[model samples]
Target: MATAAVDRVEMSEAEWEARQELAACYRVFAMLGWSEMIYNHITLKIPGEDGAFLINPFGLHFSEVTASSLVKIDIDGNKLDDSPYPVNRAGFVQHALFHRHLPDAHCIMHTHTTAGMAVSSLEGGLRATNFYACNFAGQIAYHDFEGVTVRDEEGARLLEHLGNKRVMLLKNHGILVMGKTLPEAFIKHWSLQRACEIQIATMSMGTPIEVTPDVVAVHQRDLHMAQVPGGAGAADFAAMVRLVDKIDTGWRA
Candidate 1:
């Protein structure tokens, strides 16, 4: 497979940094077993560029992705860089639609992990049965599955269902999370995945004890407070990046 030759001269410091962070996100997803072969996508908008973002090459495994190998493309799925791998048009259509509609969503992540898909298939979506799940109370939106997200018109419905929500559950499909920053998105995805895992596990043991709405409200507020400018999620993401480096520093390249 041909690798994209990153021209440092053509990229600004911020863009390069974004590329590295986005690549690290892919590697971390692989590490956590959140990736679905080469199917799911995590996209980061290029700083200072309107409607420009970076996405993984269509055929590369998440673990094999590197900072320099990521493909740069516009919102319309047109490749802006010289790379042999073509962008996944379906993924581009879905992610680009969100990025175009939500200006604050600088980073977007989509996954089809076992737990996530299980929860998506549930009629109630994510439940507030655990602390991890409490954080997403009232912050999640649901979108009905309409086959694969390949058509252009699906974008409008997706955006409509995802109105102002950071996390979305695509019925019988998977989970998608958006964030103002890469770390924020990663942390949210981690929490959402864990919530789904716990939910599924508890369900197998008969009726799960649900957290009361009052307690859930308090916990959600506290979680929100902790995600302020220099919150725990940012710190946790920093530690995660360090762990990724320790596991395989090659992701930086």
Candidate 2:
């Protein structure tokens, strides 16, 4: 197998901060045991309308990731960074669609958590049976299992499933969330994965579940409250960076 060579470049403050936040997201996922080796990806749109984004190289483990180690690539999945590591074609397939179709989504996150896979396997998929479940309500979208997402055909189907929504529970696969910033994507995923876990555990009780009325209205009101544009999510991201600093500050390397 051929390896893609990484070209080193100077990153501005914004770019570096993006990388660190993205890397922290990877580490947090790894720490939570959400990683499946190097198989999953969390991508952030490069700071321009150049149709380029940053993604992890194919070979490195999530724990080995660093801000400088991230590779820049175009929507076509071609490496703009000259990095020796190839970007995972499947990762690009889903990421490109979200970034290309959703103008507001600047960061695209995906994961293969245990509870996520469990939720994906169910018939209804992500049931709104609890408080956190109400967070998604009618907002969640589903993409049927289409094998691995390495082909162009899969991209269109995946895009159609994504529609105008911000989150997709890829049936029998994993979870993907998109946002305008790394913090938004990360926090959304955190909320989404928690919702899945909560639902599963609640269902285990084998008792009847009650759903809140006016779910769509609640979701609309909560969307702003969940990611207040420039508020708690941003602060949370900053705090996460500090947590990364406490242990694996090597991401800045």
Candidate 3:
């Protein structure tokens, strides 16, 4: 397999590690059917680099994203690197807003998978009727879709809806999640996707059985308890990275 060598001449070890993991995430998303051709995004800030983040180049499929190929940009979306690929303007702006305002939001992922989109389009976004949904209980938030999220004003409103929640369903648009680390953000997206898939499947059979709030509370507690050791999904994300290596390691470039 022909792969481009990542030029690490000027890259810090921490930044290189961040790129490798973030690029692996793109392949993981591809494997799980969570990609949208060349759209959607998953971004992680370069560790030890203030306000500089890494994003997938605009034209490649998720599977084609590579560690060295990810573009580095500043807070206002200016390209800080010499990559030939351009960044997705709207995606950068939208993701940059959260990364800029929230110090804890080091990684962000947005997706438009079929099931997630179906749930987002529903009038009753993300019903608390499944195990995965229970993880969010009262932690998920929703923003009314105002279009494609290109307008500058939409960023503020989106953040307002997101508030303190790590997950948000972009009504009629898609799902977005942010985390203090890449692993945490990836797992949240995985959980949300599972929850959305289950909700859609359950609804088709009949009226779904909505669990009690107490059940959700207990479920959430049990789930959060798992995070204490692995920094909110490190274990899960590490497993996925290994899977990506087995399938295709071109992302490591």
Please give each candidate's TM-score. Answer: 0.95, 0.89, 0.95
Q: What's the candidate order when arranged by decreasing lDDT? A: 3, 1, 2
Worst 10 residues of 1 by lDDT: 1-10
> What are the per-residue Cα lDDT tens digits for candidate 3 across 9-103?
88899989999989999999999999998999999998888999999998889989999999999998898877888889879989999989999
lDDT of 2 by residue, 133-248 (tens): 77788888998997988777777777777788989999998898888777877777888888899988988889637675676466658667645457536876677667767776
Candidate 3 regions exceeding 4 Å error are: 1-6, 225-228
Error of 3 at 164 (Å): 1.1
Q: lDDT of each model, Cα atoms only? A: 0.87, 0.78, 0.88
Q: What is the lDDT of residue 60 in candidate 3?
A: 88
lDDT against true structure, model 2: 0.78
Better of 2 and 3 by lDDT: 3
Cα deviation at 208, candidate 1, in Å, is: 0.8
User: Over the full model, what C-alpha lDDT does candidate 1 score relative to the true structure?
Assistant: 0.87
* Candidate 1 per-residue lDDT over residues 148-232, each given as its tens digit: 9899988888888888788999999999999998888888899999999999999998998888989988787676565647753
Backbone clashes under 3 angstroms, per model: 0, 9, 0
By summed lDDT, the worst window of 10 consecutive residues in model 2 runs over 1-10
RMSD (CA, Å), candidate 3 to true, equals: 1.6
